[model samples]
Structures are given as C-alpha cells and as structure tokens.
Target chain A: MAVSEESQQKRRDERVREIGFVHQVLRRPEFGAAAGCVLVLLFFALFAGDSGLFSARGTVNFLEVSAQLGILAVAVCLLMIGGEFDLSLGSMIAFAGVIIAIPSTVLGWPIWTCVLLAFAAAVIVGYVNGWLVVKTGLPSFIVTLATLFVLRGITLGLTRLITGRTQIPGIKELTEGDWLAPLFAGQFGGSVLVWLADQGLIDKRPDGLPTVQGIPVSILWWLGLTAVATWILLQTRFGNWIFTVGGDANAARNVGVPVAKVKIRLFIMSACAATLFAAIQVLSVGSADTSRGLQKEFEAIIAVVIGGTLLTGGYGSAIGAMFGALIFGVVQMGIFFTGIDTDWFKAFMGAMLLAAVLFNNYVRKKASEAR
Target chain B: MAPLIELRDVSKHFGTVIALNGVSFAVRAGEVHCLLGDNGAGKSTLIKILSGVHAPTTGEIRLQDRPVQFASPRDALDHGIATVYQDLATVPLMSVARNFFAGREPVVGWGPFKRMDWPLIERVTREEMAHMGIDVRDPGQPVGTLSGGERQCLAIARAVYFGAKVLILDEPTSALGVHQAAVVLRLIVQARARGLGVIFITHNVHHAFPVADTITLLNRGRSLGTFAKDEIRRERVVEMMAGGRDLVDLEAELAALRRNGATLQ
Candidate 1:
C-alpha cells in the first residue's frame, strides 16, 4: 500500500506538471487542423493584402462564406465521427430550399409554415437514409448517393414543373415583414460599422457604403452551433456513444450501446444541418434555385476531412471543421482579392486537402501509436 | 451456496448442426471454473450462450437459483454477467479511461448542458487498474499502446469494476506468450479472491490445471464431464482431453515404425 501510494502520488504530479504546451497540442487530433488554418490565413494575408484581405470588411466577407459551409461541415464532422456518411447532404440543402421557396412564394404559404415543412421533409429523408443503411447493412456512401440523386432530381423536376423556371422568385415580397426572416438572414453591427467608417477607422466601398457595414447572423449561427457540437462530442454520454460506435460497432453493441440509434441520430443531424444552411441561403438571397446547393455535400465533406476528421470515423472535432471552413472561405474569397485567375482554384483546393489529410494522418499516428 | 451462474442441459442448434448439446455447467462464487476444449469443440458456442450472444435452443439458465432470460447482452450485463472475448472488446484508438467508462459514462450537470465526469473517470480507471495489479501511469494513453496481456487485464478489470457477479473470459490466454499468460492467470486468481465467479476458458491444460477449481471438458459439442481439482489427476485429464487415446499407445506405435525404418535402412 505504501509503494502504491507513492506511485499514485507520482502519477498525480505527472498529471499536473507534465502537460507541456507542445505535448498538449500534439495530443489533440485537431492540432494539425488548427495549424493549417493559421497557414491558410497567413498565405492569404501575405499575398492578398493589397486588396484589403486583412481588413475588417474583408474578414466579415469571408466569415459569411465560412459560416454557411461551417454549419454543414460541423454536422458532417459529427456523422463522420459516428462512423457514417451522408452524400445526400448537399442535395438536401437544395431540396429544403425549393421546398420552402415554392410554398412560400407560389403556393402562398406562410414563411414559418414553409420552414417547418421543409424541416419535416429533411427529417424524413434523414431518417430513411439512416434506416436503410442500418437495416440493409449497406455502406452509407451508396445509400446516401442514391438519396443525393433522388433528392436533386426531384428538386429539379418539381421546380420546373411548378414554376416553368428553375428559380423561384418573389420571396422578398412574401417575407417582407416576417419576424423569422431577420433572425435567419439579418445583418447586425451596421450602425457601429458605419460610425467607424465615418471616423476614417475603416475604408468605404466604391458604392459609398461602409466596408464593415454589418455582420451576418449566420456567423453567429456558425459559432453557436459549433459550441453546441463541441459540447455534445466532449461532454455527453451520447458523445461517448458516438466515439464507440465509430470505433467498433460490434464492441459498442457488446457494451450495451445503441449503435443503430446513435448512427440514425447522426444522419438526422446531417440532414437538418443541410436544411439549416438552405434556410440561411433562401432568406438571405430572397430566392431559391434547383442548383442552389450544388456540390455542397462534397464541399462540406472536404471541409470536415480538412478539419482533421478521419474518413473512417471515431476521431474528430467540430472546432476543427469550423477552422477548416474558415480556411476554405478565406482561400476561395482571397483568390478574388488577389486578382488571380479563378480557373486554378479547384487544383489549389485539391492540393490543400491532400496536404491537410496527410498531415492529419501523420499527427494521428504520432498521437495514437507512438510513445 | 448456489452457483452464481448455472446453465442446465443447455443445447443450441443452428439449423441442423447442434453446436452445444445437453451441456450443464455451473460456476459458484469465489471459484474459477475452467472450460477446456480443442478448436471447434463447441467452446465458442457455449460461451456465446452464456454471455447472451445467442439464446439456448432448449435449456434453462439460472442466476443464484432463480431462472433468468436475457433478451440481449445488455440484459445479461444488467443482471451482473459480463464477458471478455478473445479480441478484448476494446477500441484501440480510444484512451484507457474512455474505454473503461465507454457505454455508461458518468455525466454531470443537466440536460443540454451536461459533460463527462473526466476527473472521476481518470481517477477510477487508474485506481481500478492498479487494484488489478497493473499500474497504468496515465489513463489518458491510448489502449493500443498496451501489450496484449495488458489489454486482457484491462478488460477483466473493467468487468470487475462494473459490478459483475460472474466474469466469462473466452480464450483470454490463447494469444499471449508464457509470461503474459501468467499475468492473466494471476488476474483470474485475484478476481476469484474478490468473490467473482470466473469462467476461464482455454485449450491449454497447463493453464487450466493451476488456476481452476472446477474443470469442464468438452469434445465434439458434448461435455465429457465436470471434475473438481482433487477428483482428477493432471495425466488423467490430459488423457480425457485426447479422447482416451493414451500417450503410451501413441509412443508404442511410433517405436514400431522406427524399427521398421531401421531394418529398411
């Protein structure tokens, strides 16, 4: 007992004093993602400063883009951690958008009713995707791939059938004074930004508007949801279940974890995230098109992967995905600021994703297996 | 006292193949009952039924003399029965503490604002591992870094910590070296001392003879018989395991073959 007590004391001391900054950072699965975020920011800031990429206005511009993708990326990160995928997520955004827009604009439904209806449709699609994957024992990739095409095809066909044009219009007029509209797409900090510009603290746009006019509410949504996701992943029993199911489904089942339920919930969450993104898009743009969320599923998955989430599942963080979306937003918008030909964008993105995945694998090996 | 877990005349069939037939096994508290068998000798089938992986086709299982039906593995676990399979049932990439308190992790605070009790988890994991005679310096370390024997120890300790009345270990020592197998046997003795009814399953006679209080021999899906340590000698048990083909007869055959080969030379 005396020897054991001494060893226990030694362990306690080590726990308290041995967490070096380098070790602490290396221990985190998202450390590489955090470093990559910094590298991307530095690259854009250095190469594109002349176009005001480092300015407050420029920051908010990229933040808006990141927020939209960040919402989807965060949900994708959770699903990936739960050992599943939803390739239908991107099409879900378009489907939800069209579902909301067609009813609110053409069928004369209230915006609130339309939003709820769209969410309900998303829930059903999400449930079906999860149920089919679980019951059929098929890979979620193939299952959601079918959903992707089916949802997209239906969105395109239905939009054309109803409105003659692929795009639905007159949303701004229908939602002119709706209370829920501003919460979803409203801008804030406008007066404060205008005051700063008037005092010459920031630049004015060529249209005579202040550069940092206001911050998009979606940024708030992004930060808020990221916090919630982090909490769910780290603090809850459900979070532990996610890690277990992803790590090994059979072992999880043996230990009494409801593997099917956790996976189904994750799928539902991914679809709901797609719908949330659609809501923001439709409300902000005042219109919806069949191709509104084109390629968004792949983009969200790329962002999640770049954020240090394992494609095989069981290890990742929502914060990493948040940082990944920021990197994507900065680079995509920073190219415009740099006056570079946008044709090289896809190649550049592909290279960045490859580098991030390689770096994450290296970090995972070091943290998991190495002494 | 009644056995902690008892299976009476249990038989399981998958279509036409009878995996286990009329096998009755009992493990009393504070006793180590070793189940011995060769490969495909219905050992896997028996343990699966005991751990609720599969229901017995025709039999009754009793817990402390009361009949019990386990609908799922969770139901078995809830009734104080736990199983540690050959694979150790661990997530390699997860931390020791996380793997320890995985499915039923303790949480603090209220709904939508709750968090894992990390302090409690780390403390309990380290303490429990130490109690099991393994000093885990850091519970935060990934379980994959531990040796195979250490992983088995961790799994056994986890079962004990979860209030298991009966611990069923399937081939826990099959993959270990000499020293590691000793470590697992030591853990089994420790568990028995702690009053847990341990079902130690292995094919090695040497492994079973030392730590087992009761021995159950299985062959071709039927139990040869269950024997107490005093009732059976090591040589006799080995003969029983070899299907009554005594080693003396085998050696005589080998000698006759050698003489013929020598004459031919």
Candidate 2:
C-alpha cells in the first residue's frame, strides 16, 4: 500500500502543467514581432483607409518594397542569429550592381555571364570579410564597418573611372530581349489587375493603366528565400551549427564545431543574398549607380532587430525576420499613403526601432520568468 | 592492464609563472581518479594540459602506453577524451537535444539535402538523460532552464554516451549544494561502474572520499603524491591538502581558543 501510494504521488508530481493558448503564443520567440506587425497593419488600416492603402495596388506596392528589404533582412537575420553582423551589405549591393552593369556594358559580355561574375565577386568579398573577422578575432561590427567604406570607395572610383560618371546606364538596351530578364524583373498577374480596372474594381491612372499592374518577381524571390532560410535554420545540421556557434563560440569550439568555417560560410551567404537584391534592383530600374544602395545595410539590420533577434546573438528565427520586414514595409509605405510629411519618415522609423527592441526585451523576460 | 591515460612529469608554465611543475597522473579504466588541491595548487593547469587546452611544457603524455601530443582540444576529443568544464558544458540558449549533439550531429539525408536526424537526437537525448537519473520533461526545452545539478548530470551523461574513454570533469561539484553535489557524485560512481576512466577535479575531500578510487594531491604547482583510497586516511588527506604544517597549527590554535571560552573582537 505504501509503495502504491508513493507511485501515485510521483505520477501526480511529474504531471506536466497545462499552458494556456495565450501563454503558449507569448512564449514563442517571434511573438513580439508578430504582435508588432499586426499593430502596425491595424494603425495603417484605420488612419489611411481612405487613401487606397488597403487596395490591391497599395498592398502590392508595400509588398514589393518589403520584398526588397525582406530579402536583405532575412539574410541579416541569419547572420545576426549566428552571432555576427555584415555592415557591408548595402555597399555590397551597390558593388554587385556595378559589377553586373559595367561588365555587360563596357566589356560587352553576355547578360547572364555578368550575373555569374557579380555573384562570384559578392561571395569573394563576403568571404574576405568573414576571414578577416574570424582570423583576427576582431568584432564583426568594426570589420564590416571598414569593409563598408572600402567597398563604397571602390564602387565610386571604379564607376567614375569606367563611365566617367557615377551611374551606369544603357544596360536595359544592351540586355534587351535577354531570356533572363523575365526571371529577374518580369511582372506577374497583370491581366488580373487590368481586368479589375476594367470592372471598376480598382483605380486607373490617367493613361488608362491600372494602378495595380502585377506582382514583382522580387516578391517571389523574397518568399522563396524566406522559406529556404527557415528550412536551413530549423531542420539542418548547418542550422544547428549556426545556433551553436552563435550561442557560445568557445563552447562550440571545445566541442569541435569548426567555428571559423561556420562564420565564413554565413558571411558568404549574406553576400550572395546582397547580390540577389542588387541583381533584382539593377534589372528593375535598368541602371546601376554608385549611390544605389545607400543606407540599406542599416535598414536591413533594423528590420532584423525588430524581428525579435537578440543583439548579443544566439537566438532568432527567419520567419520572425520576415514578419519584422513586413512591419517595416507596412510602416514605410503606410506613412506615404497618409497625409503625413515625408520628412517625418526617418523619425517614425527610429521610434519603431526603439519600441520593437523594448517589446522584445520585455517578451524575453516574461518567457524566461516561467522557468 | 595499462592505465587508460598517463601523464608523465608534465609541467606547464605561463611566462614567469609555473602553473604546473613536474606533475604526473594516471587514471585506470573503471575507476574515479579525484585530483585534489587548494586554490593555487595548479589543478586547473594540470586538467587543461590533460584536456589539450594547453600543452605540457616538458613532459610526455601517454594514452594506453603510447606517447601522444594533442595540438588542440579537438585532438583530445578525437582520442576519446571528453572534458566537461564547470558551467561551460552546454550552451544555455540551445535546446536539450541540440546541446547533446552540438558538434557531432547525426544526419539522415544525402548531400545538400542532408539534415539533422531530429527524431533520433530527441529520443537519444531523452533516454540518456533518464539513464543519468534525470527526468527531462521535454527535449526541446533550453538547457538554461535545467537545475545546475541536472545540467552537470546531463554533461556527464553526454560524455558517457559519446563513447569517451576518458571523462575529464573540471570542478563539477564546486558550485553545487549538498543534495546536488550528492547527485553529481552518484553520477561519477555510475560512470566508473560503466568502465569509464573518470578524472574528477574537486577541492572537497569529503566529496572525493566517498567515490574516489585514487586521489592525486597537488600543492603549489607540484604533486605531493598519488594514493589509493586505502593507502591514506581522510584526515591525513585533508591535512596534506592544506599543506600539513599550516593546517595542523591552525587546528591547534582554534582548539586553544575554544578551550579558553573567550570571544575575541
């Protein structure tokens, strides 16, 4: 009887405490980002409802912009989660664009070959940045900061030397009718927008063109890359290595995790993502300029920080970063749709960054308190 | 049979400071070798040398009677020597299963498509923790949430499960309470029972006396001697650890003060 009673008591003590659904959601690492995203959307919906902010056209516009920032933000998220930063991302974008344009125009190389060359160059730059950071044991912030200037200088000097100007033009004419154009810069669902315009379901420009034309291919790239990154972070060995190396580099080294190799690979991946963004931007605008990607590196990092990643590293997710970029996209475009002055945009972004970081810190504290 | 690991006359020096001087130690299979010392006895330096964090400045290290040199910690791990440093064994933010298989994760798929074997990692982590007498509620929980003793147990269980021939634990029980320290000591005994050559570094004689088969004493960067449990009594061990003369004099002074029945300001 004593033994039976003890067993029953043990079972009772060992029973898992049932958690409520609200608590469950709050416990997720991305909960702050998701909540912030919803709040931002609701704010725009209520304030800018009459400015066609909810229209398909406005939605696509925000999404297109979000897609661009999202691409860079997602990669930055991966790097941040792995316990590093790449401040050279924005400059790398300009550098990659220049690489694509100058080669195709000045050298008369085929468009696709230029794409390959740009990608290779981006990866090499990223690798060198990572190698210097890990080998010298310097903080990535300082290393990438130095790289940022170096790259910007190179892009400016090279562009001026080659074209006798800051921007490279006539790329669209040179790469006209190229097969790879559609893959990078083509639009989708244009017929749907046109039909809606004919049916009086959406606004039409003075020239009879629908405000909603089609989805940019960059949106597709954003979605696809987010999915791939989420998979790599959550389901693969390299993903685990990323978390390990970022979480505690010394412990990871002791366990033989090859810390330098992981950091280097992440750097290369970040650079490749930058190249993709540059390629899309170059093809869409049909030009590459020295100042094309100015301040984009800060925007990408801001998006990641808003996504609930720790500034100190070791904890984050890609889906969270996606939602963070979504929040950013909505706010950036939503401000324009409102009657607010465009000059207030930077101030609003700074506020959002501060609020998101405070919210993330609060959520982390609440979740850890349960233990 | 040959000892599992042998450190012959190993000395480690840091510039002008000699941290470990002419120290030799060994651990046999199925035994717990407790390395005992005071604050500056160079126990850490000795363990670092053994774990390959630092190379011995002068002596040869023999694993099963063959001379070997470890260039890094990874080399030591490759030789089946796993070290679990105090408070540094696991990453606090990572999940239990992830911590269990941090460096050597199991993969199920082919190249590029190759992925972590999640089910296997979770199941094995759960089983190994249970085997170490810990009932982890969920393998997905972060290691930081575990109790300090539970974390140490997890580290010991991990080393055992990973086929380590020599388990080097650095001050595993130093920060633990009485109950937790008992739990860790029990795990050490369990490891010894499973035929692991355990090197348990601790300054507590009472904790060591319960489970150690051989005790290696160190003082001021030098080894006093290595003695089997039956070869020396507990009092002698404690006195020797406190440098004998000083400890005896201190004890006598305390006794005299107590006999006077006076409290001093």
Show where candidate 2 strays beyond 4 Å.
A1-17, A20-22, A191-210, A366-370, B14-17, B245-265
TM-score per candidate, in order? 0.93, 0.92
**Per-residue lDDT for A1-371 in model 1, tens only?**
99999998788768745666667667677777788888888888688877877788788989999999999999999999898999999899999999999989887998988988988998899999999999999999999999999999999999999999899877877777887888787889999888888888888998877877789999999999999999888878898899889888888888888998999989999999999999899988889989888888888888898888888888889999998898889988898789898777778888878887887777667656734
lDDT of 2 by residue, B66-179 (tens): 999998998998898999999878888888899999989999998788888999999999999999988777788778777788888888888888889999999999999999
Residue runs of model 1 more than 4 Å from their true location after superposition? A1-19, A205-209, B242-265
For residues B124-223, write the lDDT of model 1, one tens digit per residue.
9999999988888779878877878888888889899999999999999989999999999999999999999999999999999999999999988999
The local distance difference test score of model 2 is: 0.88
Each prediction's Cα lDDT score? 0.89, 0.88
TM-score of chain B of each: 0.95, 0.94
- Docking quality class, candidate 2: medium
Checking candidate 1 for backbone clashes, the offending pairs are none
| Candidate 2: pairs in clash | none
